[model samples]
Target: MHPDVAVDILKKAETSLVSYRDTGFADAQTSAKEICEEMNVEAALKQKRLRTTKRQFSYEAPDEPITDALKKMEFSFFNVVVDMAIESLRERTGMMSDVAKKFSVLISFSSELEKQAKDLCNTLTSGDHSDLNYDELIVEMQSFPKQWPKQNMTKLDLVFLEEKGLKEIYPNMWVALRIAVTTPVSVVSAERSFSKL
Candidate 1:
């Protein structure tokens, strides 16, 4: 962008910074300076020709005296900062359009590579059965119904474990268990936040 246009952008951005950040003139001035530096503008010209308003107090003008003073600083002007950054990025790479297309392609490829890696890992580890503790417990729980032991105590133990796992594994069921334990069988407290369940 031209230096004049860049200056305008900086001025607008400074106005934005004032409102958005609740910062003073010093902060806004610093922002303008930073923008100038980033754009590699000449140092002398980068020093903005800031206009300072002087109080012209008089008996004729007793109330509001500030005139031509910019009001309501807006942060929308910070788009200049974004534009400058994008320009720099384009310079480092080839062009803005080409760089954006390349970035999207890279992202797509990376996502596919990640999915492939996860699948490969799962396939390699599928049958290396170093039985996790939970795995063994799950097997025992599944087998109890088939065995159908004649003893009442053994059957009760299996039923208890199965119920415990159901209540613990699912969040909604766990909340329901808490309600069952705490209150008089009323469906008020735990019924919320369980729409999907």
Candidate 2:
């Protein structure tokens, strides 16, 4: 899954746990109040409700299974899961500089992005493409998007560059983008395959 999606799932899980706890608490409180009223307890009156409230505020609700389940749950486990998810997200996509560079490359071709791309390519290739004019290639890239409808262009990856025109425009940057996006942060699949074997 994408790091953003993973983070969202983690947040939802945490929120759901809290919501469950709060709903259980509210239900228990309401039930206690109802029982007090049913028994015609004088302390159940609005002005003296606290005296009766103290009597009915037991955490162990024999009749309310949901409330009992909530009380039995170890809520700290939710915090642990949320923390692990956050850490995994950070490990996967915490390279802000790389993310920003890719964003600039995908959004719109410009001289600045070209320079950055060239810098990145040079670092990867040890200056083999140093003589290439990245800015001119970026200018060519600007026209490639016009071939497709505005709404059709969602993710700016190699799939969009499979067209012959785009391939000829900025082959170097396309290769770089493909490699960057395809690279996996974890080798869980490989590990699982080895284990199965």
Candidate 3:
């Protein structure tokens, strides 16, 4: 999947999880209530503090309505789950950004993205690795975009270059695009972007 596509997926996932979770909890609560009613018993809920400090006393909670108890359950369980999912998505968003930073060079060069290209080069060359030439990459980045038949293209797909026959003339871009294309990717935003591709 494209980094942008993957990022787009993660971007909206938190909202979707939040939006849908409430309905899911409501449905589950209703189902549980039905089960409890079929058993012919009153719904019951009580609470007690689990711990007490040396100078502290635990408080016993009075009986509460089932609805209140369920709400508490949602806050303790479902809310935590949703929060964890959101946090995981946030981490993945950062990862997708890093992937995009490395692959930004694969897109048509822009004055703004030049820094990313340089950074990518520095990263690839760091710690006794020198597979890429910074100067050559810079030259190629500036000149390579002109080869495109359309200068205004959005979301460049490197696979299309298969027919362009310009790899030798723009080896650095070829390498960068190859890396980007080969990078592992995922999900709906990715699904949509690849469909567009």
Candidate 4:
């Protein structure tokens, strides 16, 4: 299942709890206490089943402990969320450091791209710019969250840098940003392709 779907399910479950708290049940005449008790039991059973299914599908090795598998699964889910946030250029609220670390991981995944990014950083730091200064571009990128009020810049923004006239202003930085946004980390499509093989 997609992580988005899982998140949706969890959100719905939370909303249901809120609704249950606000209005005990649809029928006011009925015994709300008994009904809630029964619903709680049912919810517990469903949660158990869901956990069992997740454990079964997340099997890593023959001798691997379930706790270890669960830990790995949690990390993978967190990584996916981080990747989605970074690609979409979401504000990420207070996760700037974490996002930057994940961005580093994503860039490091490709040695060629990592080399290019390093080269661009070097060129900028070496003061060899013909138009835009490297320090200025780095400052702009770092302060993007504050500069853009809505913080709605997406991967498409990086793709069409000329629309915002950013290419001419931050050429090297724009290229590196484009590469970061365009890199594909998810293997869902690749897995699907291999399924038919």
User: Best candidate, lDDT-wise?
Assistant: 3
For model 3, what is the alpha-carbon lDDT of residue 79? Answer: 81
Every model's TM-score? 0.18, 0.42, 0.69, 0.28
- Top candidate by TM-score: 3
Output the better candidate (1/3) by TM-score: 3
Backbone clash count, each prediction separately: 0, 0, 0, 0
User: lDDT of each model, Cα atoms only?
Assistant: 0.37, 0.49, 0.69, 0.43
lDDT of 2 by residue, 1-197 (tens): 22233344555655665565546555655787788789976433232222223345678764432333333333445445545655554443444334444434544445575566666545455445453356654664555555443432323334466665566666755665555554432435555444211
Per-model RMSD to reference: 23.9, 12.2, 6.6, 15.3
Shift in Å, residue 158, candidate 2: 5.6
Ranking by lDDT: 3, 2, 4, 1
Residues 35-60 of candidate 1: C-alpha lDDT, one tens digit per residue: 88999974333233445577676767
> Candidate 3, residues 49-119: lDDT per residue as tens digits?
45433444458755444456567888889889878887888888887888776766566565666687778
In model 1, the Cα lDDT at residue 137 comes to 28
Compose the digit string of candidate 4's lDDT tens values, residues 1-197: 22223334445655555455334333331454467677874312112222333445555644543354334443455445544544433222223323333334212333354443444465334355543344554554543433432243444444455677767655655665554454433234555444311
lDDT score at residue 177, model 4, on the 0-100 scale: 58
lDDT agreement of model 3 with the native? 0.69
